[model samples]
Target chain A: MHGLPANLEEALLGLVREKLFEGGATLTVETDLFAAGLDSMGIMQLMISIEERFGVRVPESAVTRDHFSTASSLAAMVRRCAAPA
Target chain B: MKALSDSIVEAIFARAAEAPERAAFVGRDGEISFDHLVADVERWATVIARLPGFPAEGVARIGVRCPDGVQHTVLMLAVMRAGGCAVPVAGELPGDERSMLARTTALHGVLSQGGEERAADGSERHEIGGGLRWERLAAEEPCFPVEDFESVCPAFIRFSSGTTGASKGVVLSHGTLRERLDSANRRLGIGGTDRVLWTLPMAHHFAVSILLYLREGATVVLPEGSLAGDLLTAACQYGATVFYGSPFQAALLAAEASERDWPGLRLAVSTAAPLAPETAGAFVRRYGVRLSQGFGIIEAGLPLLSTTGEDPMVVGRPDDFELRLEGSGTEGGLCLRGPGMFDAYLSPWCPRQEVMADGWFHTGDLARWEADGSIRLVGRLKSVINVGGSKCFPEEIEEVLRCHEGVVDARVRGEEHARWGMLPVAEILPVDGSSPPTDGELSAHCRARLAGYKIPVRYQMVRELPRTASGKVRRV
Candidate 1:
């Protein structure tokens, strides 16, 4: 297999760790972002980071509490948006 | 001591009485009429008066800590209505910062809701109505002169940035607020038919925005969220005519996939921070409604607004205010002599006469005049970094960085950004030069101490930070 990243989930977790907060080390794919101190301001910053990292535009509608709950959920949303029409 | 005029809350009451049935606020929870709004404000004001340690004569300084909504608006107005100066304790402040604000302001009490917690130390917490609780701090002597504060009939005490260091507690008197509202409205022209879509936090922008809208008999449309979809939906449903928000929001709405053109939108203004030209361009292209740039500050109200919508940088001619450039040539520090200038600074007790002794309030912006006589901001003379509208000083961040044992010294600077006006970057001189503190360690330490936006985006290891001749850290 090619030396690509394991999955979108891991990439997003890496992003949350590097760009957003320091809780990335303790955070698993299923770790709750809100529990880890993700606030309204954090969500806005995370959205910008996701857009830059994934090379995709997340619609305002996609910014819901559920989709932003965990790294896994965010990766799923990113995958859905990044996929071809 | 100067004699006082009518309060802004009283003016709001008179305006509400003129047309009681009209909608004052239209939110996701439905519309609330002017009469209902007035009634709620009065009821809360009565409740505030009954609270223990409610001042018998002189004005009480009460901190308002609530989520951004109609309730927040009502409680602030109520505090003013009850003859207390309202201080907005921003929800983002850490516990220590909150304690600093409470101590510095010498607050008589704090009206806060659940979710955001500050320990009740030497203060009694009583459950106030409307899911709000009152933390009545034990009465203590304020650091500043109470008579000086009360003489101007103070309405609001707003802090520009962090509580520590060079933070200014800008005090805006009731008469000053009224005067500024009138002056600002000369350009805004918001009237009864207009419905303003509110997006910015009430804690930061209530004095000029929310108060002005209510005073002018306009309905305020409070959106469910800050997202483009929510804003658009609220705007369309509420017949919102005016859109006022930050450039970041304008960029988001511009990038939105929705094809529905909000035809009712008339005047869209981007304020709080500098508006990017790209954001202005995209918004105009998206909605066919030109975006105007507003130049507003804590010390001075909305004085300059770009009316022609030609350039985002050229925040248009002063509205009912006089402006001057401090230095000789075209480019210098922007200065203004205005009707609605702040009354005083709280902690040091500097009055208007002293601060404006030179007959001008020196704004820390470096600007140049265009051929058309419109002012265009080029740079800042101060070292404050504006991350998308929230401001943080370099010294504050450097202090936090220096707190880490590994850091010997640090310097933070605002690096120009394409999207956000600026992003903070740090240079740290480490104790062990061979093994400097990693980004993760620095970030984690900063995250615990400072607001997220104030935290430096990137950390660079250095042997030394440049210093001025006086041995002070050099800032560009």
Candidate 2:
């Protein structure tokens, strides 16, 4: 629910664009990841990449359709999870 | 080979009574014991019994919109226990498509997820427990009187995945379903000692696999997430013996950098899509297990299986069905006739006789027999692309494209070319969005795996390909 830092959002979008979409796909922070063909497997790969890169663990409960709806939303969730409790 | 009950509900009850404390299904949320599963089924059956349109005697057809997990499994069993045919509708379907299925099936009621129940014009609504709402729709218009097919009692009505075009309901009777489970189990050898790691949507494969697993008293483990790491962990932790997944899932697993051998994995079966030799080889190389393929059709239940896993392309021999190649040479239309075939089609209420010609169901698949007497699937007849008097199968080309490291999924279709009758064009989904192989790189990869004529002339990279509710790429 917390917003992601500007740099973090850019990094997350870049990762998604690279891993889930083709280089030719034009992705923005507002672009719907699911609409762009981000399926369950894609989300899993994204979560793994995010964890490896940012050290944030996304709980299974946090992996709903809404959380991964867009690059911005996913970045926000990743940021929230990564923040100190 | 044993004396199994004809009714799935009866089999479930028997298993529950035999092993009350045994785990029936293990999901991310929690595990359900056989006793708990039976109790849940009874409670939902009581709710169905009180529904308005549920018939007092005969089997009532009801639609269910529930996600794939313990809840969906329970609800389906409940529908069967209540003497109704369970129609499993995908929860993610658009409202229009859902309503169309309800209308076409002439469902007596639909049990959908969420808190509240609303009924429009000709339907009445009631709230069932467990966040499920039941609505009774008006009866379908009388076109022809409903007649029983071969005196077999109907149990489940499943709509085709509709990867190619319009979906049709394939009705399976209780007897037919039981027969399918028995026949497939003989080949699969799943039993009480086995635990299956399930990932495919329950709605798409319930009758053939999930229901069959339960009937055979095997434990089913549903992974918490689709992550390859999570699934591999679940399979190892739960001691899964059999793994049922799609080619995409297998590719993901093959890509994961897991060092430990998946200790308990005895069998890995791929369905719903073609199994690329690259995928099969990678999985076997990574895990030391062959990824067997099964050629399953909604009309005929799991007729062929690669039990030996010797050749990934060879789908092995028929179990219960009598398979025949209808044409000549190495390529011909695959036709089958067997027990446990679909009893009827829902919309027009056409009997099986209407569709069958001399007891053979002409599956739209193009296949050929190997020298070893196993059937190797070429592709779907409708998906063949002819180029300059030569023919090629899209599945063959797509498999080559998928073998590329940068490609995640590929769909090949024919384009109208002025010179060649039809030229094959491909839309590729990159493995990771950042770097996809260029057209030249993909062409080179294809050249290594396929003949020159089979390579796609053009390639378009996309983020994702359109898919059906069942997760197969929708070829439009």
Candidate 3:
């Protein structure tokens, strides 16, 4: 609820934060999430959460952590992938 | 590094002695309590120790086949107790290789569910497995004087085919074991309440993490076999809270969630290889859980990514070790620096210099760093196929092939040609048992998803593509 976008980003961030907090980190958007903390395994969860929450099918190419590195990038990705208007 | 002392065995013995009726291991064969398991170990370890030839240093070089179901865990601890090494062997390999491995380690003994006797020198044959019996050596249990070992003492050894085509032993020290266990235990919040599903054999480092969970008194449920449906049933039956496997296993679970009952699983972890986007998304949609992928090779320790599911493609961050991508230009490689990395491959041919240049262990995988700096594995460098002048990583193309609705599996390999030098070949495995997708259909599928140069020039509709023992699509 606090970061990213609505329920979609919320669910995504919630899972992200669980791992972030597990390592006792305070991660925000634009943070070098993958390099700073997020790992390959975390990306799998993020993609799963975004699709489940927003009902969007994220292309495998787009799921790379590079797209989600920053809050703005992740938010932009969500806006693009969320089902049509 | 923590030593395998009399204390661990004492704890199991105390638990069993305290509550002889408490369930120790439970599975399809019914539940065997602490009393039964310990009693068996107490009876077996003595015979195991006396088997004449268990090497002196590391306790038990005891190899078990495909794992003897769940009872193998107790047997492992007991072997550790009797000052023996516990070697976990994956049954996916050919019988010849498995047999060679048993003899290569100078095994003290070999155990399996049902098999004939292996002629091991000095080592006695303690047939815990059902069926055919061999003549037992003297059943006298030797009194073991618990000896503390250095961090480098060989606690267990796993055989993996490294850069060389042949299998090479990767020995892990007790320190590395404890380091990984402690890191995963504390960082992942995996403890007594966690019951993990073991789809892969415990002999590998991926399975090594399960031992960490076990030390916390957690339950590990082994899959019935490779079938995803069977795995789902085991997860539900064991009330498994966590699941782990290679990307393929995770994908299959996601692909077939509705067919299997998996309501209790809270965590689904993917490792060993790249996790397809479909696999990650399907699992989350069906189970409301994330199928997290982690970065680790044979040399590096089992690195954990964060739980924060931010992006599917990003490998997330480094774990107990540091991950660095080296070599600039087109040929650079991935490198890892941390405690979990092995000291060296057992092969003395190159020492550790080939992979571990300086302090970093070069991972043959290459990737592009995202803006957030998360890593994405493109594919093995060796698997890169040259399409005319341009370079195409097979994983990129394979991902496209997997996205097709009817395509269940796909393998992209570089094949030599008289004109093109090398062309990409696409091998598709259909969802149904029928023939594979046609060339035109596959072409159309690729034309939509890939670049002009990335598409395969030739398509082969084969019943199956060759795969490694662990089920990875293999290419020369």
Candidate 4:
């Protein structure tokens, strides 16, 4: 319902806020999601959300600790996944 | 005939005695042989048996709250083997929900690990090894009929997800556990040679998963973490052959970034929620093995499995069980009668005979019979949201939302999701038109009361909620 996020990183931050933490968390582009309590279930939810929202299917092999550490890191992966093969 | 308590304990020990050096559990800590596993379990049982107010001839209800590991398995097995009933208190539950479970189940004590925040009131704490501490609560008479509960030889009490008030928890007996394991293995054919890679939460899946693997003398591989990378590394390190977990985990494994393949994997079973066809397809393409989605009910053990791996929806024919439909049509409420059916429902105290008075347990799942005599789940008759594999009822979430000071009334429903199966969203009617509860406030309120999975992903302000003719909230 709200206006589309300006960029991919902003959009991912929005998604993380709404889905993973249920809008109760204060997050930024560089916040450590794992330190903020992002768990295995949260990772799965974010994976599916990325697929559904951005039409990006993050490969299983791409799910690494660095790629999932922050919103910006996830945004980079999503951008890569969205680019043409 | 041996008593139910002795029978299960003897069965497990007998396996260890036969192959003492066989690895029973392979986790991050290290591999534990069957003999060491049995010895550790016996040590915990000795501690449990000496707890204050432990009944000599009746069952003592003890809650086990721990992360999924060998310690969790040993404690639960110890509780059951020591002639007590084990109730798994999931780690994700908030304090309020935890207290509600304790009171409703009438747990005599709780064993917690990792120095959890709170212990039951009026309880004494004793330090158990492996970071586990047992809190012994003051003796109190149970609200339910204790005699009826003890008569069934209760082994485990699993609180049905989102259940509260009268329809509380499902009770599984020692004998019923044995029967269900036997029936499930008839289809699985798991033996000492199979090494199962375990990822699902032990609290939600112990009855049919870890217990079955241990009883069948199979080695269980507990991954360091549930990530795809961790699972793959564990599988290779432990030489795992069986992968039993939810579709979410399967999806991750399918999309795993590593070039390494799980060549030793013989069978992979997906359960807990319906599997999306894409996930099934991708999994096969990735690993050259089909993902067999199974239909596992807490009331009835795993009765149906999709062995052919053709249609993920079509759960293969019932094994050692009889299935039927509630209506004459092809698609109707699925019902079944078989071994491993739960012994009773705890709070309102309904026995198995009363529950199966009609000779079948209505699964509340809408299903269709395929031409090949397999079963395909169409939908659900109950208003439940399966977020990933965990289930939460809309009514329970609605109750929590209504308690918010800014909300007049609320309605919750499951929204179709691409990955998690279904995610819950809420519509709220505010008490004052001028002001409404902020999303952050509502989220914080719910986070303090419910599990993380049960919290709604989105909230919308509405003037009115759709209702039935009788004025009750009409569910879609």
The count of residue-pair clashes in candidate 2 stands at 8
lDDT at position B356, candidate 1: 85
Off by over 4 Å in 1: A1-40, A47-70, A76-85, B1-5, B119-122, B161-165
- Write the number of the candidate with greater TM-score, choosing between 1 and 2: 1
TM-score of 1: 0.91
The deviation in Å at residue B179 for candidate 3 is: 0.8
Estimate how well candidate 1 is docked, as a DockQ score.
0.27
DockQ scores of all models, one per candidate? 0.27, 0.08, 0.02, 0.34
What is model 4's interface RMSD?
Answer: 3.4
The iRMS of model 1 comes to 4.0
Model 2 complex DockQ against the native: 0.08
Docking class of 2: incorrect
Candidate 3: residue B315 lDDT (0-100): 67
Runs of candidate 3 exceeding 4 Å displacement: A1-85, B1-3, B6-24, B32-43, B55-60, B66-68, B117-151, B161-166, B203-207, B223-226, B257-261, B309-311, B328-331, B349-357, B382-476
Question: Across residues B27-103, which tens digit of lDDT does each residue of candidate 3 receive?
Answer: 55466665677667776666556655555554556665534455566556656666655666553333434555665
Better of 2 and 3 by lDDT: 2
Better of 1 and 4 by TM-score: 4
- Candidate 4 C-alpha lDDT tens digits along B342-391: 89998778998997899988888899998878899988887878888988
**Candidate 2 at residue B118, lDDT?**
36
On residues B316-383, what C-alpha lDDT tens digit does candidate 2 reach at each position?
88757788887667789888887778887765666778878577888777899888778988756676
Note the Cα lDDT for every prediction shown: 0.83, 0.73, 0.56, 0.84
lDDT of 3 at B256: 55
Among all candidates shown, the one with the greatest DockQ: 4
lDDT of 1 by residue, B1-476 (tens): 11223889988988899999999989775789999999999889989988987778789899999878888989999999888899998776666567778888899999997653662356788887789999999877788998888898899999855222467698999989999999899999999899999888777788789999999999999887666777888999899999999888887788765767888999999997898888889899999998999998888888899988878988998657888998799999998888889999887778988988999888888998888888999988888888888888898789889999999999999899767788889999999998889887887788766666777877889877889999989886
Select the stronger candidate by lDDT from 1 and 2.
1
